[model samples]
Target: MSLAPRIVLVHRTTEYEELVARHGTHGQAAFFLASRGRDIEEVAERSRRTRRALDEIAAGIPLTWRQARVERADLDRFLFAPEDVVVVVGQDGLVANVAKYLAGQPVVGIDTDPGRNPGVLVRHRAADAGALIASAVSRAGAVDELTMVEAVADDTQRLLALNEIYLGAAGHQTVRYRLGRDDDRGAVEPQASSGVLVGTGTGASGWLRSVWQERGGGLVLPGATEERLVWFVREAWPSPVTGTSLVAGHLSVGARLQLTVESDRLIAFGDGMEGDAVELVWGQTVRVGVAGVRLRLVG
Candidate 1:
């Protein structure tokens, strides 16, 4: 008996039918994926509808579908082998990291959002809505919405954010923060501020920098000698003490002063992540690093 062509499916989506019709598994095609909650039923219904749509495009193409649990070992097998084709049905984050894993293979990304794919490699570009969809399609993968179609390769290969991320002062209290890498030998007092910020190249235009009387900013640009991150903060506040005599127009005897970040916590946060509140001690350190991979999108 001859074996049918096999195509590994990653992240369930509606685009599989066109893939199956064009390249039938001949009964050997199987799907491997992590549990997607209870959406499998919906996918099965969509598959039936997709089969009907494919009939008009290509007649008499037989397709048999089955899904199996995915294990860590199975992940290794799928990534290394050269299958007929591999379809990724994950969110933007999933797609971006997947590319790194299957660096040399042909992995077709499928997502409802278009911005995940880096379309034409425009110089010094930031990911936008239009750029996302076009990126995926331009890469040889196809694009469609709410229906199955041949997957394209126009992966713009950029970051995809499901929820928006922002930086701003909490409450009315102006915060004191700092920006700057560790000095020689990772020592030395870091730069201090009433406000500081570190954001992605894309986040430069956003709220990385809060309101600063001295310098209105919140950014660490490219060509920065060490790491590429922005930071912001407030510096100091001296508390005035008014004695009974002072209230009566007499001189005061004592006063107190407090640092900004000490009184108020400097926090960093955005969508899908819990906020981190940091109180920096003069000699201590707080570090931020870039994630290993950018986000991905498929339309």
Candidate 2:
């Protein structure tokens, strides 16, 4: 390791920022929200809290060590160092947002609004940043190596997600793809569906659980660090051209879910970040599985 590991502080744009950006000015955004009987102050207050959290985290960094602040929008364009310690300040989703971009760096998740967020990934408060940063840098902290999911395209392109990886249509219409498990090549089923979702145990509490509940426990989900993965075909349409027999299943360790495109084009996105996705066309294939790499989270 380097004599002084760099600290990479990651955060996402706030709702207030998004509103202003969309409406072209804060006054216009406030007017729009006020017209709907919503107070813009609530949104602005959240941004202020986030800003304070950022300042606290930045203050915690030792002057002798190198550091960098990264926004969520620019994660794809940013490069991380091997000896870096990542500190993400935002909601639990932000942790998922940054997890895909990391390798094995230890991450410190700080909750800016613990009361409203009810976060799991972010276990610490902004006020605790200094001590947590010290412990992590000194290798005196305990880290939970959370399992993740990965999707590898035929062309060798790969995408990772801490929560779940989704393969579906870019729009609301159903997508056409052949789905199968790696071990059972003979059971490949072609179907028309909204899309497919392959998720980690960390994702069970969110979108994955909804699917599981809606189907009355069709597939059992793994735990956060479990070496297993689960997949489901959303709203599979039954027709002469498509079948719904292979809708849900689990991927054992090292096993993968195979997808062969039948539509003109389909999209593969991870952790609900549709903006950054892998584009798949007819006849293309991608494999989804529990990723070998894990997220080292320091609590």
Candidate 3:
């Protein structure tokens, strides 16, 4: 028998959560914030709005639909079925956060604080959930196929990210590796720097753009739907055995930038989630490129 599509609601803990976590109670949190010359009401108000939106969204789901809620911290442990309609109930970053774990699920982004948060990813209001849910089930929704980046370690471990994948030291310290392509010049030069970042077009709008701006805007960043990849090496120092020639560049679809570990330890992580990462030891090679899977996000 066939299975019905499940509705997966994704959210992240708010600032109010951390406030109460440290202060024990909302009243105590308020007092602590007030003592620091800050108003806790603002934080509480935002948290209230987020919770209200989540409730409204949940209420709109059909009773027959199998639904589940997964927090941002629990995404790593949660398993998503193929027939799942993901509804991200938070800011823009939450959508990007859930994108890595998903294969091709349709993500509906709901924004709690429209004025405070950028609605680039979470572009819809809670009231639109009913129609959006119907559209997604019928495959009639406006879905954007966003490109993603992937890194594969020599040991067969892999990582995916909607924004970017970073390979470097755990502390963001100087990374030692050989940067090059697979053709004639397999591994070009040994580099020691902050690390390397392999990003997609979606990433270009954020961190990649900042790095491009810092480098005088030479790299050609692709669009959100483009099947392209761009790379950048941070603070690559010059030495007798090292070179900075492969500082920044772009990769066409299916092409990969190879990096062999020269340091005792290096970590590969996606979308800034350093805690859940792939570890690479000396002499290990990691190839980063555009992933075949794309994020099917409802616009």
Highest-scoring model, TM-score: 3
Model 1 segments beyond 4 Å from truth?
Answer: 1-180, 190-195, 209-227, 234-267, 271-285, 297-299
Residue range 35-101, candidate 3, lDDT tens digits: 9999999999999999999899888888977889999999999999988999999888888899988
Better of 1 and 3 by lDDT: 3
Better of 1 and 2 by TM-score: 2
Worst 10 residues of 1 by lDDT: 243-252
Candidate 2 all-Cα RMSD: 1.5
> Each model's RMSD to truth, in Å?
17.3, 1.5, 1.2
Residues 1-299 of candidate 1 have per-residue lDDT tens digits of: 63443334444334444444544642322332113233333444556543333232122112542222222224434534433233443344333223323433344444332354332111111112223323432455433211000101112112212122222244424443322332224222222333333343333333432322234332223221222333333343333321111100100112111112232344333322322222233222234334333322233
| Residue 255, candidate 1: alpha-carbon lDDT | 13
Badly placed stretches (over 4 Å) of model 2 are 1-3
What overall lDDT goes with each candidate model?
A: 0.31, 0.91, 0.90
Q: What is the C-alpha local distance difference test score of candidate 3?
A: 0.90
Clash list (residue pairs), candidate 3: none
TM-score of predicted structure 3: 0.97
